[model samples]
Target: MSPQRPTNPAMQRLVDFYDPAVMGKDVGGRTLAQILAWRDTRLESQHDYIQVLFPLPEGSIFNEYSPVVDEETFLYLRHDSNDGFKRAMRRALARMLSFYGFDITWDQDAAGKWVVAVDAKKGAEEDHFPRWVRRMDHNHLRITRILRSLRVLGLEDEARAFFAALCWTFDSYRRIGDGSMKFWRRAVELPLHIAPDGTEVDWLEKYEEKKEEKAEE
Candidate 1:
């Protein structure tokens, strides 16, 4: 008999869990504890981010340009529960943001809660990318773009939830093989645009065209 494929209820649950308005509320409340507990109970795995080797081989010139990770730290994050991993990530991002003293806006209601917003941002950022491995800089850039876009759209909570999903997807890919890495590369290669219907458009195509226009100019 053929081996059966595991049912991916997690994927379905994740899709349902990512309601933009709901996510926004969670972020505004800074309810990471609740979110983490929810994810743990539903997903049953603590790992929320994934790791993959850069397309370039080790020791290649590109390797030097890529980001690096502390192997032990990466392993710990990979194996820890979702809550523990999120906390660790928050601490790391807090240290990085403290260097800049940046102010993060969690929501309109949180205007007075600078400390809370910062704490939440640090946690969210860390939770989204717990391990800083090589080739993961793109992941950060993607996340930063998502957050900025959310701010522009006034969808702070949705942005938080989206970032959470992104991190979760990344983690899922890491657990899978290099095939997952290839999938991410392909996904990123495709242009992402926002449609009038509130869907993603081929924004990358527009980006390429603008670059070409600039080159011609």
Candidate 2:
């Protein structure tokens, strides 16, 4: 069956942008695939794409033009019925990982059950990737965005799994500091409680959150 259209026009456009089958472009007139194909320098320099790729319920602080995630869009993206969209988001996550010079792979753990791990790609250390992850840079903010985005978008398992790998990497390398890692933890564990309206309640936003609860009560 074809993907269902969304009731909200802005959300409809965002959904098409994310769903590969729909092949919709963002406000910048670039397809998601095309944006992913951009070189690392371009990826680093181009700030707006990250917001488009890993949107949140709230607007981005740095990018004024970022798309805001809406209730209808959130439901459709997170619905188990749309497995394809989830897979597409996963692929997008991997691409972002690669941009940071990390590669994700599955390997058997102690019990031989397969598990996910993120490691610096072989020879990637010769370049600036390792140093970048180590530095107190804007990359951490991007990581923050994606991690939270993955969780809110219904890939919580994948987000937790990636965090486990990151934990291991931090322990083994001792590069990324404790302060930076805290953001990662908060993003994955953020309580995106679904409100009656079918969207996540941003617990961090006291004003709006209180308003919603007051209205409900």
Top candidate on TM-score is 2
lDDT of 2 at 121: 74
Off by over 4 Å in 2: 1-4, 106-115, 193-217
Residue 180 error, candidate 2, Å: 1.6
Clashing pairs in 1: 24-157, 49-171, 50-170, 50-171, 193-201
lDDT of 1 by residue, 100-214 (tens): 2223333444456422354233444445334432344434432343343332222334445444444454564463234334433333333233322223433224644664689
Writing each residue's lDDT as its tens digit, candidate 2 over 87-165 gives 6787788888887767876678899976766777777666646545584778888887788788778776667877876
After TM-score superposition, the amount by which residue 56's alpha carbon in candidate 1 deviates from its true location, in angstroms, is 28
lDDT of each: 0.33, 0.75
Each candidate's TM vs. the true structure? Answer: 0.23, 0.79
